[model samples]
Target: MRSVVGGVLSVVVVVAVVACSSPREPLPGLTASATVTTAQTPTPSPTIDYSDAELGIVFEDDQSLTGDEAEVYHWVATLETEYWRTLTTNTVSPKLSSIASPEIHVRMQQMADKNASIEGGHIGGVFRVQVRDVVVEGESARAVACLDYAGATFSDPNGSYTPEEAGFGGISRQELTLARVADKTWIVLTRTAAGEC
Candidate 1:
């Protein structure tokens, strides 16, 4: 899956997510901030068209990446992509359990609860994800990733959420702890903010 197509990082995947993650207060819950927020009932904005974003997820192709490191990068990218779909679909995706911990799964559910009352707008952009480092020790693994959300906008009833606005920001760095379950698949144990990268 790490095969470079055409160039070092030109293989952009425009994933058409059918059902995805949660988005209510902001991306902090599922994003790099990684802190679960209490559900808030925001004033409902009247909008007919539901907002959706065209996902342009491009991962850095490094031939040196193999084994555990490659697996970590792949799963983390999948998790991010699925989480962003929450903004477009506005429903907490149930698929997270397969890739994330139980706590992270609940956090996403909280986000969807918030999305219930917000207005929608189609936010267009690409979410750039790059793995910074990976460490493996027995059945435990940790991966650090830098996400560029400069091109993305959160779901705002008022229309658009500026990068500096309430819901989210530009670029963020996250450190995730993963555990190898009985199935031999890596499940994300924790995802915490690691400041700007």
Candidate 2:
């Protein structure tokens, strides 16, 4: 990503549209009406061989946090990092379903579809997540964290996009909603912009 800000147009293009998913059914706490099911939510199957599935986004665990709090942070970072990777590479990840709910996945896939024509872009900077707090009741959880996307970047040969043009800036704070799936695996059900850190 040459324009880490607007200079990194690919990252800006991807991150610019990062928080743009509106689900058909309201997820747990949200009062908004979600999207329609006619939307084909793609699922990753083990049988589908992936030649370029893993983008190798790194998310480190915070030693200061533990238990469900830390795990939630991990999932948030994982999903966000993977999403960024997906956008930069312009490919859907095999682990998407494992970390993101179908609602989130659909949005990511849509961007990937748009990115199919774009060539040679990459994700830069770190997906640093700081857990502020987490409230878990039963199988559902809500979390607040700061995601440092200030240094993030994505770029293509033509410089087709820019942060200013894309309109995504400072993903410094976030509110994440999660639900428990099979095992303790938590997926990002929904997330919204929570101002800045």
Candidate 3:
């Protein structure tokens, strides 16, 4: 369903995901990057400094994000929001408006609908999601997320209560990898998800 609340357009993102059209070439094997390095000293986890500027977007405490982890987390959150918006509206092509492919967007939307159907569904609401437990190594990071996803009775695509019936609430795991694109920013080269609850 589609509707407008205040001015924000809200859509119920499905709980499913699509496989990548091009599966990444697996490293020679699962252990390709896990090879033990004698000279490698483990980097200590950054002290939780929730006051970091980058954390302002979603996190307010050091418990979930820190350092480069914060920046990458925020970046992913921004991308996810934009991607969901485009996917729900179906006004813009996913390939042009998002870092993901149109196929993936289509698949994810379907999956979300299925998941919501099983969970009683929703019509519409506001959403706030953030990455949690980010572990950064060099330019790569992995983190789980806590999604504060909900829908308000605003824009209903089919003029039905579908969005409100399926008020948002789900927790999914996400993996992210980043490469430096500039002195202060990095580009998310890959994001993959497996299984959701």
Separately for all candidates shown, the number of backbone clashes (residues 3 or more apart, or on different chains) is: 4, 11, 31
Model 1 scores a C-alpha lDDT of 0.67
Ranking by TM-score: 1, 2, 3
TM-scores, in order shown? 0.64, 0.57, 0.44
- Identify the superior model by lDDT, candidate 1 or candidate 3: 1
> Which window of ten consecutive residues has the lowest lDDT sum in model 3?
9-18
Assess the local accuracy of residue 181 in candidate 2 as a C-alpha lDDT between 0 and 100: 78
Q: Which residue ranges in model 2 land beyond 4 Å of their true spot?
A: 1-63, 119-127, 160-166
lDDT of each: 0.67, 0.65, 0.49
By lDDT, who's the top model here? Answer: 1
Off by over 4 Å in 3: 1-66, 92-124, 152-169
Best by TM-score, which number?
Answer: 1
Candidate 3 lDDT, 14-96, residue by residue in tens: 21223324566777747555666688788877644322232222333344455677676665655555544543444343443
Task: Report clash pairs, candidate 1.
Answer: 21-86, 51-121, 51-122, 52-122
